[model samples]
Target chain A: MLLGKVKGKIISTRKHEKLVGYKLLIVEPYYGHKKDTFIAADKLGAGIGELVLVARDYAVKSGLDKDAPIDALVVGIVDREPEKK
Target chain B: MLLGKVKGKIISTRKHEKLVGYKLLIVEPYYGHKKDTFIAADKLGAGIGELVLVARDYAVKSGLDKDAPIDALVVGIVDREPEKK
Candidate 1:
């Protein structure tokens, strides 16, 4: 799982068929000091600038089709921002 | 996929049974300017400092046991350094 802030949303015209209904959010890491941002699938309605938990790997696919081409997903919107390490 | 140079090997005394024979290499992303390094399973005999390709998510598991706890994998070693974008 990754602690992140939903930075923004992405609009793609051509995407996988399985990704039709999901919103794509740009997530920035809150803990790892990583410079890159991840574009992840969102089904729980996470809004921009919100703190959330992102699940990676196949574990993220259980909520969608098995072959959705999604490597990251917005799993939770934090009730409160957790202390950063 | 990720383009990276193998940083080093990880020696773990206790790991998942499915990961027993696979070498774990530290892969630093060569693109996306990501600061985080990934611990990825390597079955292609990639050596330290070698440029390689890493496949992430469930797509990485096709070469191993599906239930393996591996999310990153060294899929191919580059023949030469490709042009970086």
Candidate 2:
């Protein structure tokens, strides 16, 4: 799993059938030093600027379901602030 | 590659050396239906709520160079809005 922050949303008009109705959000992964940002899907009610945990690839597909066809998935939303100590 | 939005940050007191300076972001992939959010590393200067593209697994390692032990990495940030029509 990885850590990131919700940046924004993405709207797609043309896409695959497997990916309909899903909310797209831009995310920045929080490593120790700096923040790395990217795009991902939100299954939970995660809003922009919320700290969230994510799973990817096989982990993502498996987390959602075997037949979910998802490459990424938001597993959890961070409730408390991350400790830098 | 996949799509996601920046959600939040992750701070770990102890981590791998390769991941020391790398930024980790919470991301949700845009899978057409519902967003499948995940955590990924960002190499670009993407802010919160920015639509970005991600490369996972081998793609990530290769994109950032083999020496890097990154499982996920942001390759591109979406400049325009994704069409939902």
Candidate 3:
């Protein structure tokens, strides 16, 4: 898992049928220097600027239709920042 | 999902009880320059030096015990490299 801040919402009118009701959030990882960002499926109602735990991979597809093409998922909102080196 | 090269194996005799029998492999991402590496749970029987698709987050927990603490998983062995810019 990685720590990321939700930067914005993605409005997709046309997406996989299984992904119809899920909210897609653009997240920027806290640990990487690259400007690359990815969209994560959110079920926890996380908002922009909220820090969240993003589960990547098949884990993102958990609890949803098995055919969903989701690649990242917001599992939780961090209540506190973890101590870092 | 991200593409990674399996570099080594992780032998963990003591782990979450739900993770006792899983194989863990060290993986390096193909698109990053950082020397950082991570362990991924493998169910596809990927071998060292092979390229594999890593699913991150809750997606990694698919098909396993729901309580397993796995964060990365090997979902597929790469049959072809994706075209890069």
Candidate 4:
């Protein structure tokens, strides 16, 4: 998983059947001073600018059910700073 | 999948066993007027600011092998504009 900040939401008039009820957010992956922005499927009602944890690969499948059609998903919202380096 | 420009590469001193040889690129997902930036795994040697296609979920497994430890992987680089609306 990677740390990211939700930047904004994406609105699509048409989408895949499996993505109908999920929210799409543009997330900027934050690694210390580095930020790599990307979009992801959000089902946790994460707000803009909220620090979030993004799950990938097997983690994603485990976080959201194994059958979920999600490659990248917002798994958690960070409420406080983790141990600093 | 999403189109993006390869902004830069990420160098990690520590990584999972499967990700050791794969290149990681900070990508910005592009949607015409809307540009959603994010990072992704790039296996195609894509350059910075190059448009590319991202594969998610089952697509990722099909693009790569089934056991590849990638949920979001750069599958292809776009050389021309797709059909506009």
**DockQ, all models:** 0.09, 0.07, 0.11, 0.08
Between candidates 2 and 3, name the one with more favorable DockQ.
Answer: 3
Residue-level lDDT tens digits of model 2 in A1-85:
8888776776654333344556777666766322234456677979988988988776665565324334557889998868867
Number of backbone collisions per candidate, in order?
Answer: 0, 67, 10, 4
Error of 1 at B29 (Å): 7.7
Worst 10 residues of 2 chain B by lDDT: B58-67
What's the residue-level lDDT of A48 in candidate 2?
80
- For residue B14, give model 4's deviation from the true position in Å: 39
lDDT of 2: 0.65
Q: Compared to the true structure, candidate 2 yields what TM-score?
A: 0.50
lDDT (10s digit) by residue, model 3, range B1-85: 8898887664533233455576766677877643435567787899988989987765655646564546787888999777767
* TM-scores for every candidate against the unseen true structure: 0.53, 0.50, 0.53, 0.51
What residue pairs are clashing in model 4? Answer: A37-B37, A37-B38, A38-B37, A38-B38
Descending-TM-score candidate ranking: 3, 1, 4, 2
Q: Is candidate 3 or candidate 4 better by lDDT?
A: 3
Classified by CAPRI criteria, candidate 2 counts as incorrect
lDDT by residue (tens digit), candidate 1, B1-85: 4457788989998877878888989888754544678798887788898876565878565545456788887655665654432
* Residue A60 alpha-carbon offset, candidate 3, angstroms: 2.0
Query: Would you give me the overall lDDT of model 1?
Result: 0.70
lDDT of 4 by residue, A5-81 (tens): 77776554333334457676667667642234555778889998799998865566666543544567898899974
Worst 10 residues of 3 chain B by lDDT: B10-19
Instruction: Give the per-residue lDDT of model 1 (tens digit) for A22-71.
Output: 77766778886445555677889998789989888778767565555466
